[model samples]
Target: MKGDDDASVVVAGVRVGSFTRDSFVDRVLTMARGDSTRVAVGVNAHVCNLARTDARLREALSTSTTYADGQSVVWAARLLGGHLPERLATTDIAEPILRAAAAEGLPVYFLGAAEGVAERAAELLRDRIPGLRLRTHHGYISEGDVSLVLDEIAAHGTRILFVGMGDPAQQYWVENHRDRLPAAVLTCGGLFDWLSGSNRRAPAWMITSGLEWLWRLMIEPRRLARRYIVGNPAFIAAVLRQRRHETPRRTPSGVL
Candidate 1:
């Protein structure tokens, strides 16, 4: 095992890449150039942490390039003997990638989020990325209705698809439909809501310190209090244990 230096690593037969937000977009663009087949891109964090439990998901993640979406994950990586520069929030990553896609003439499709959110997000993205090919599919459809959604994407010639219905669901959707779509899929939880102006992100300082979770808890205390206040602490404890027991792996560049 090599140290982390923005390169890919194979864990449990899956190839996982250590990427910042910028590198993630670049790599996906690279993948899109050769084959517009569906590819999964994860924004790593504790809430969406599948690396510890599910071997397939870990392998899927390893085979895909996972970006450090949350500050907590980046901090944990550093603590667990990996070197990472910063947290690449998915919300921040989406627009820039869309802009790049537009510049390169790559068509993008938005999947997930409530009715109208996807459409609104497309509009917002178009404003930023002029002449960008953007399409949307709402999140309220029935599970059996996925075939219709798949058909729409196939017709659109979508090179990139953003899944914003939150994790596990978004992750599952991408995994289940990767074979049917001709696009690279990135799981972006709640990003559509933020882009559509329905949800406001916390201040930069809070995000930098990994306390954005706290800000979210404050916004919807009754809903998120238990998850962040109690669940996250336990999650942190588990990560600490894993860090202590696992040996640091060096990267191909020899950095640990």
Candidate 2:
């Protein structure tokens, strides 16, 4: 809500914020220092498609500041006559955010990923940005246990919380608890694994070519097959449908 709602385009009924990397980070960092709590959600094709069916996801995006984290979503927006300054991939945004947190002396919390992963990532982040106030909690908790996690984070005085529990669940948690938190939150799904170096990114060439999905599929086919294989096509179809509905057909006169 703190971002440019006018610049956002409705993707499957969810307003996806179109922000450049610097602008997105600036908005979030500024919000973190505000009087009230704010949340930043990374929206991609998979997330947009998920929003169509998941009421929790829809509600989360309705209130959270979202950045375009997928190339597919950028292309889809262009086809629908919407402009995204550029792809603000969540992984690319994370380090800069951490740097800002360190500069502000804001204590940060990492919540998600497998056991030991968050601990490992906190070490890396502390090394990457000296004087960073970092904390870790692996995202293995029942709904009954979330309050304990929240209490611990509050007790630690965390100002920036990164929740990487993936998709709708992460969104749902942040939505339900943002009011209770004293921090700005981001649902950066899978970011802890990547930052910890437990999961390697695709080669730079492949990432630039937008074939990172293929690289991930090659590495974790069993896990990502459905998301990349099925979700991708579904996303494209939804985009095309939205484009047709929102854009006017040109007559032979080349005018509406």
Q: What residue pairs are clashing in model 2?
A: none
Can you tell me which runs of candidate 1 are displaced by over 4 Å? 1-16, 36-38, 48-56, 251-256
Model 1 lDDT-worst window of ten: 8-17
Q: Write the per-residue lDDT of candidate 1 for residues 68-162, one digit (tens) a residue.
A: 66676666666666655676777887887888888899988888888998898788778877889999988887978989998998899888888
Please count the clashing residue pairs in each candidate, in the order shown. Answer: 7, 0
Q: Residue 140 of model 2: what lDDT?
A: 92
Q: In model 1, which residue pairs have backbone atoms overlapping below 3 Å?
A: 2-250, 2-251, 3-250, 3-251, 15-62, 15-63, 16-62
How close is every model to the real structure, measured as TM-score?
0.86, 0.92
Q: After superposition, how far is residue 169 of candidate 2 from its true place, in Å?
A: 0.8
- How well does candidate 2 match the true structure in TM-score terms? 0.92
Stretches off by above 4 angstroms in model 2 are 1-6, 248-256
